[model samples]
Target: MSIGDGYRAVVDLLRHLRFFVAVAETRHFGRAATDLGITQPPLSQGVQKLEGHLGVRLFDRDARGVRLTVAGGRLLGPARALVDAAEDLLDQAGRLGGPVRARVGLCGDLGGWTPVACRALAGGSGPGLVVPRVAGSDRLLAELREGALDVAVVRHPGVVDGLVGGDVVGLPTRLLGADGPLDVPLAEVDRPLVVPPRRHQPPAHDQLVDTLRRAGHDGRVLEAADPTQRAALVAAGAGVALETSPGAQASGGLPPLRVRVVLPAARERRPEVDHAGLAAALEQALRR
Candidate 1:
């Protein structure tokens, strides 16, 4: 009456459970084999081996179709749950070897701040970005709330309800145009304004519009998605554009044009996420 003598069997536990589940679901060995993409003989042999290991018959054979025995009926639910948990564990294990991803959104990458923030987040080592999505400030904020983005670096005057953030830097802005001499007051310039889409950054849009109206312009503006396009329109004498200060453009190799500091710099910050560790990392990155 040795312990090993009573129960001696070798079986791949997970494989046996999977085979049992397939057979239990179909109730027909032939149908189960077809579903599992295997031959009926191996399926029958696996089920027999599983029953021998458990020391109980899991199914009843008849002329119509197979049916679950008392033991099989009791084990089906737990077996399915176990298989699901095992697959999920395997998936997480595969991700453990890869760098953790942080989805970041940007409001037009103005003044080249988006790249700077991304480098800071990477800390010079590990996976950097999951393809930064560019949208208006309003859309970016909305994405942050919807759990689509882990963080976002956006401009001021945009609504950020139910989110926490910290200002990382201030990007001083200037007016670009062909008609005005560089360094004049905003009121002295007289050119149709070329601005990014107002729907994306309404606060900034209204500020510029109101400021120009006081200067005697009719409050008319042309919309362009790309800063380069804005600069092109201004260069071609189509209109003036509010853009990053001249100092910020020095390294970007933008087309040369008359520039004057008008509106002050906009604040750049990151929206909060749920995880404390990740939020701390983002705060640290913005500080850099």
Candidate 2:
């Protein structure tokens, strides 16, 4: 295609990418239409137009509704970025002389250090507004990579390309039991293990799994996407919960359980930044 033709095509793709993203996230035409405040037919047509422009099928339709095709999956990350960037552009245009805004993502409080970090960032005399988002580690990391987030606090945040982490704090790991504190050895506990989902932070999960295995545990492991839910499970005698003591306490009031330090400490995931200013700010926050 000629340069002019390619440019127009790109513009057209941008126009319909929002519809594609809505459908991909909702996975249902009707819901996507409702969310987009448009009729189902037009929404479907817009998606079709996008598919035609890209020359790839974005979704597979069946009685089970819609599912993203492999091509769709590949496009999802970029599509989301396009939509976010468009929104940001509009926001920035509206706020033309306002302070710069910084988007921050937090992965489930990062063992109660999140609040402190927030305070540190807020206390900064810098000329930027900080907006925070709370989400799972995996989702936070993905957004961070996509430029949707300026900085993020995640658990066991190893090394991410293009981003450097700072303000590392060691979180003391604990095991909680139901109804009260129990001194039961790891090998003696037979209940399921209720903890964060492994996919969100595999390194931390693997370390926990290895520790349990060494203690002779071969029971079922239950995945809890939220820390409060995991603590609730422990309170109900559903299973044992392994997490930072402060994090579990921050989750909410729960049934009393025996608490023991299974691991002396695990480092809290702090801000992953691309700028020296952000790194310095986070380091200052960690000191508080």
Model 1 misplaced regions, further than 4 Å: 1-97, 123-130, 167-169, 178-181, 215-218, 249-288
lDDT of 2 by residue, 1-288 (tens): 322687777676676898899899899998886555455887888899888778899999999789999999999999999889987897678479465656777677354556766666667574246787878766776666445666666666343434555545545445568875555667777887887788877766676676677777774688888778887888988898755534333222222221110110112222332244554565555443
Backbone clash pairs for candidate 1 read 171-265
- Residues 1-288, candidate 1: write the lDDT tens digits: 223553332225555677899999999898786555455897889888778877889999999889999999998898788767866886577478475466667677364455654565566442453446667676677666544566666766555545666543445455667763245555565667887788876776787677678766678888888877877898899987656532453322222221111111122122222233444544454443
Which residue segments of model 2 deviate by more than 4 Å? 1-49, 52-88, 94-97, 124-129, 157-159, 166-169, 180-184, 245-277, 280-288
User: What is the total number of backbone clashes in candidate 1?
Assistant: 1
Shift of residue 227 alpha carbon in model 2, Å: 2.6
